[model samples]
Target: MIRKINRIFQDYMREKRLKIGKNIWDRKNKEKIIEDNNFIEDNNIKSILFLRYDGKIGDMVINTIMFREIKKSYPEIKIGVVTRGGAKDIISNNKNVDKIYEYNKKTSEVKKLAREIALEKYDLLIDFSEMLRVNQMMFINMCKAKINIGINKKDWNLFEVSLKSIDYHYHISNLYLEILKFLGIKNIVRKYDLFPTNYMIEKLNLKNKKYVVFNPYAASKHRSFNLENMIKISEIILEKNFDKLILIGTKNHLSELERIKKRFGDKIIIPETENILEVVELISKANLVVTPDTSIVHIAATFERKMLCIYRREIGKEDKNSILWGPNYDQARVIYVDEKVKNGEEIDINKIKIEKLKEKIDEI
Candidate 1:
């Protein structure tokens, strides 16, 4: 498809430009990132800009804890976020964020955005992404801010305060907490908040009902459980007298879930598509959630809903992605299986037996 071709071209161009920027163009400035790694305090800071390139739901949701803690510590300071275009939904109607800047992921527009953000004169700048994309790094350096903070585990650094020297050994949420501590904000947010307005509450009729929610898809195939297996699990739960199985997903997943509905009949409540708030609204009403290693898991955790997370060990090691991103609160269980297929690994998820899934389901 044309979309796939464009993504390939974008990645190629970004890699090419990063090579050029690293070896030749911005070599001196990159060196300067290492020379100044000490902490810099800004007592009169009033405005802050946050840079996050990966705008996936899970990425944004995890960072919501960071956003909340920052605003809680400094109620008067204005916060601006620069994220990939479609990801504005994560913080779209959020009251804590003052501005949302959209970057279309083209290397061509880096400088233009840099000039625009520089004029705002942010007192603090933070890069929350794990991999420092070169064009984004270049933009981070160009943006004028008093105290610049970037996180990386190694020699790569493009900000005045680099955490590369310190090995981060906590969960993703805790990692950000440590960064906030370094910035002189010691009070960390212990809770995650995703507010749903009355409009969102009235959007769905499933409120105050007993339903089991199923998130059968993920951003990548390896991270999702097999749909066939998902159906089997749904059958098991329905037999236990749960009200109904609700399947929530984005537009790309509509047809596949439609097929599931065709086979399962009215016992399944398959919504064609649900936006982030709608998903949150539905999950907040569900009795329990069965999902893959996706944002739904994290969001369910925020509500403290019981979660049965199914994931592939190959996608991440036990410590890195499994334990780190597993349910932050209580009442959650996880099952991992070795993957067999690289793309859309329906068989990989089959490695988890039906009885094992039922046991976890029954526990909830």
Candidate 2:
């Protein structure tokens, strides 16, 4: 099958890239590999830079705790973040971040950004990349910070303070906080903070009407609820304790959302908006948030909004996805489609029971 061939090709490319990366890193930093965990412990840090170039909104939302807590604990330490795309938007309003450097996958751009970072001469640099890709290693090596910290990997001799990987299942946000814990930042608060924008404030005008946000789409189709199930869920929510149902998704989902819009007409409210922050603002003020496995879950968790999330897991098997990246806030409920799935197959989220979903809506 095409999928199997693509997987094989991807694996081949990954191994090839890893071999090339190790060769390049060995030649580039032959005499620069240092291991000193005590450098940060001895109060010798003044400035810190974090590499968060992965452009997922949920991942960036989780990283918010790092920026805020570090600034809170060490008021004098200058904080800088390297990010791109939508990930940049999440922290654009963060007060704790003193500077942000943007970079992309292009070698020229990354090299230029690395040179710029080296000029800053940060006392500490942190790389949270679990996979030590060639470009990531190239950028990290080029940064030339005094002390580099990151999650430990087996044979990669890149970071100076390589903290051991977290062994137990914890919310990813808390797992990231372990880096701060290693740096002696004890006054950590396990919560998320999002700044309100004038654009978001001006755009949201529900006028005190109670509304629930229903996001039935995900980045991948398999993770999204099917149209039939979406309608059923919408009907269930509307019949329960909500005044209006606000349907939301990205521009790519407009046609499908429009189709759903035709079914309910005036009862369903779809706000015209631009950008993810607007969607975040929409979730912020909602009465309750209902979504599939998507970044909306994280946005809802940020505000501790009452949330009902849907996901799929193989029956009688340990669901690692839910265990690692489920909603972190209280007042959150998740409905998992527990059915047997064969190997190399994606679980169908539409298989979730409508009765169970309705039960959750009533409880919320």
Candidate 3:
């Protein structure tokens, strides 16, 4: 198809640009930053730059906790975040981030942006993604920071310092926090904070209510519940005596949501905006939240709210099964369908029974 050909052409161009950009930078080995008693003390680290350019909303949301922990570890240290414009909200309001440089993807002038960030002369730069793609490593070299750090990998060879996880059995957030712990950040707290503006609070208007939230979308079709199954789950949850139940997702689901609203009465509400903060605000006020494996589940944990989570079987080693992302909090419960599947077989959301979901909801 023309669309697939166009996609391949675009990818080729991006790779070409990345290769050109890598050559433009001074790609040579430098001194590696290691964990020492006087690592921070000797280097006189005053400010740090964290590079994570993944535009996915969920990745951005989870990194907020990492940013907060870095600030808490050193009250006086300044923090800088470099991310895409689409993902800026995750770190925009955090008091810990003294500077945030967002990449405008429509007109990407990364070299120009790098020149400006380099002028800041950050004491340390860390790329958390550890991805070796052209865009991932290009800016780290261009920044001209004193000590560059990233996760250790064969292709992540540009940074002066690289940190890797000693233990692989931890959630993504904890895996990221290990970078700080290696740098000797003492008493790091694993907490997430998003200070909502007064307008945001008044917008959703679920303030101090005994309502619950239902998010039926995930990153992929296989991960999210289908409309028919979602409706069934809603019917089961409605059997409970909760105050109000809100149904929300990205604008892609608007048509389906309208159908659900028509099928069910006014009890199921829809959000006016697609901005993720509204979801967080709703989650913050809700007595309980139910969602498939997505950013909503992570946000629920960030707020320490009671939640029931559902996830599909991760087909391969890197698919991130429930054991990896399952909530560590006592208030959280997860149902992993087809937990024992070994090969990369995609499981349908409809395979989960209504009675099974109701049993989980009844416990809540």
Candidate 4:
């Protein structure tokens, strides 16, 4: 199949890249992070900028969570974020972010954006993207900020404050929190927040119902569950008196959504929109969420909704919090599946043990 071939090719490229030592991270620079975090906190920063270039969903969630905690600690501080163009909508209404700066990912615009960033006069800068050393270096050198902080793989002298070098194997959230800790903000809570306006909730018209939501797609091929397995899960859930099933994802996932529709017909609801707030509002009304490791999972967690989080076994092992981090009031259960197959390699959906998932859902 085309999917199999694509996966094989991707695996081959990854292996080849690894063979050339392209994936290795520097180990020596891990100690500097602690020193940098300390320096930033001691200075009492008033304005801060968070820079993350690889603006994927998970990365955006991590940044949003960190920004929220930072705002809680330093209520007077103004926090802004700089990310690639498409991510502005994701954090547009986030209370923690006072502003957002969009930068083109291409090299040609880097210098121009760098200049714009330098003009901000931030008191502190936090760089979340690991490979953007050149970008961080430009910001540190050009920006008027007194303190520059971020994770570094190498001893990049560009940052005024940098964390101790770390292995790439760590969970992204913990790494992000470690950056915050390095800045003297201890007791950082690991909760994610997504605020959907009343108007947005009204638009979705999601009333009280024992509905289950499904997010069957992931941006990464390695992380997405099998579409067939997802369909089967939908069928099984519908059979269990959870008749209302909502499928959530971006426009790119329409085809996958259609596939589920063919399987479930009118039983599944596909809410299509570019707005994340709309999606958050939709998930807020659901009784339970079944999703791959994606932003919607975190959003559901914010709403204190019970979640059935599906994750690649490797990622699940790396961060226990991947399955557990949710709103304080709700319980979340994580289901770990191997990375080799899309969705547990055609496991029997009827036989799939979801007692834990059901228990969590019933708890609330």
RMSD of 4: 6.3
lDDT of 2 by residue, 220-274 (tens): 8888888898889888888876667888877777788778779978778777776
- Candidate 1 off by > 4 Å: 1-19, 23-43, 153-157, 164-169, 197-201, 314-319, 339-347
Best by lDDT: 2
Off by over 4 Å in 2: 1-6, 26-43, 198-204
Q: What's the CA error at residue 267 for candidate 4, in Å?
A: 3.1
Q: Write model 3 residue lDDT over 325-356, tens digit each, in one string.
A: 66667888887665445444577666776777
**TM-scores, in order shown?**
0.83, 0.92, 0.86, 0.74
CA lDDT for candidate 1: 0.71
Quality of model 4 by C-alpha lDDT = 0.64
lDDT of each: 0.71, 0.80, 0.73, 0.64
Range of the 10 consecutive residues with the lowest summed lDDT in candidate 1: 27-36
> What C-alpha lDDT does candidate 3 achieve relative to the native structure?
0.73
Clashing pairs for model 2 are none
Task: Say which prediction, candidate 2 or candidate 4, comes out ahead on TM-score.
Answer: 2
Order the candidate numbers by lDDT, best to worst. Answer: 2, 3, 1, 4
Residue range with the least summed lDDT across 10 consecutive positions in model 2: 26-35
- lDDT per residue as tens, model 4, 1-364: 9988999999788667544433232211212333444545657678988776666655676567788887887778888887764466678788888988876755457667777777877877776555543444454455555566656634554455556654545555666677677666878888776666456434545565567788777666555656766766676678666657888777777898888888778778887666776777777777778876677766776777877776544433354444333222336676655443345454222233455445544553
Q: Residue 252 CA error for candidate 2 (Å)?
A: 1.6
Model 1, 1-364: lDDT tens digits are: 8988998999899888777765542322322222223232334668888887677767677777767877887788889998874356757888888998887667668788888988998877887756656676678767867667666624544455667433334456677667767766765766666765445434445556578888877766655656777678778888876767888777777787788888878878875444577677677767889888888887888888888888766643334566667677787788776554555334356577789888888887
